[model samples]
Target: MAKKTKPIRPPADPLPPVIAPRVSAPPDPMSIDPEIQKMADDLSAKVHSPARDLELVDEFLDLYRRVFQQGNPIGLNEDITAVLTGRNARNGILFPPASPLIVKGQLVDRWGTPYWFHPNSSYQMEIRSAGPDKNLFTQDDVVKNPGPDNMGIGVGISQP
Candidate 1:
């Protein structure tokens, strides 16, 4: 029978101090990025439940395409939050009574990318997650619009 052996230990050396690359940092008391501050301000103003936001984005796109006859495409970037919340030029709340109001505003996705909402035109907007890559418009981007394929938005709908 083969005998088990204890692994030899290397000469004792002090362990290095733990350091990690922080993708995000706590807001400095005296300093803040304007873009991050914008996100914070938007969120603090009035956040909505993520589920509700999803429904709202989908519905808004559907209406613009189906009802308005504008054939608007959804390709949001970041400012779409203002459009949806009526903080933009539009005065009407397209989706009102923001449901399950838990978040103060557009919530950040898992990858730390804020839900970008950009209005391409009056009839079109795009909303998406930066995905794991944390970059917009990449192969990994989680698009809310789902483009022409609709990314299997519902049953019977299929993407190639």
Candidate 2:
């Protein structure tokens, strides 16, 4: 009979030594710029609604009109917007000589959905979008048009 021998140990990983992951330091909020912070706040406001309310729909509709139709007779829509936004100022004269318009925020409904602009006439356009239900071409959709005494109508809107 032969004597029993102890089992041999397996070799360890033949690579770099294992090291613990380095923890990152916390960021300093004070390092942020006021203007950038304000822009962030404005963007956040645009993506969300107050009390989840869509009261800004009317304001958005009015802005679309002024941006799309209120341009000078000979001014292109792009030129008008660029001028309004202080871009391509050389074309600014193409826009109305009156005080230039500056639209704020994004072209979105109160629900953060982009408003659809369907041009049906030279001076009139149909700006619409899905309302709170988030369904397009439905009764719960908002619609606004050109002309005096303009009013927006949709299912999500509560008429007083």
Q: Each model's TM-score, in the order given?
A: 0.34, 0.33
Evaluate model 1: give its lDDT.
0.47
lDDT of each: 0.47, 0.42
Residue lDDT tens for model 2, 67-105: 455523223333333443324322222222221122232
Model 2 stretches astray by more than 4 angstroms: 1-106, 146-160
Best by lDDT: 1
RMSD to true structure for each model, in Å: 18.6, 16.0
CA error at residue 32 for candidate 2, angstroms: 24
- Quote model 1's TM-score: 0.34
User: For model 1, how big is the CA root-mean-square deviation?
Assistant: 18.6
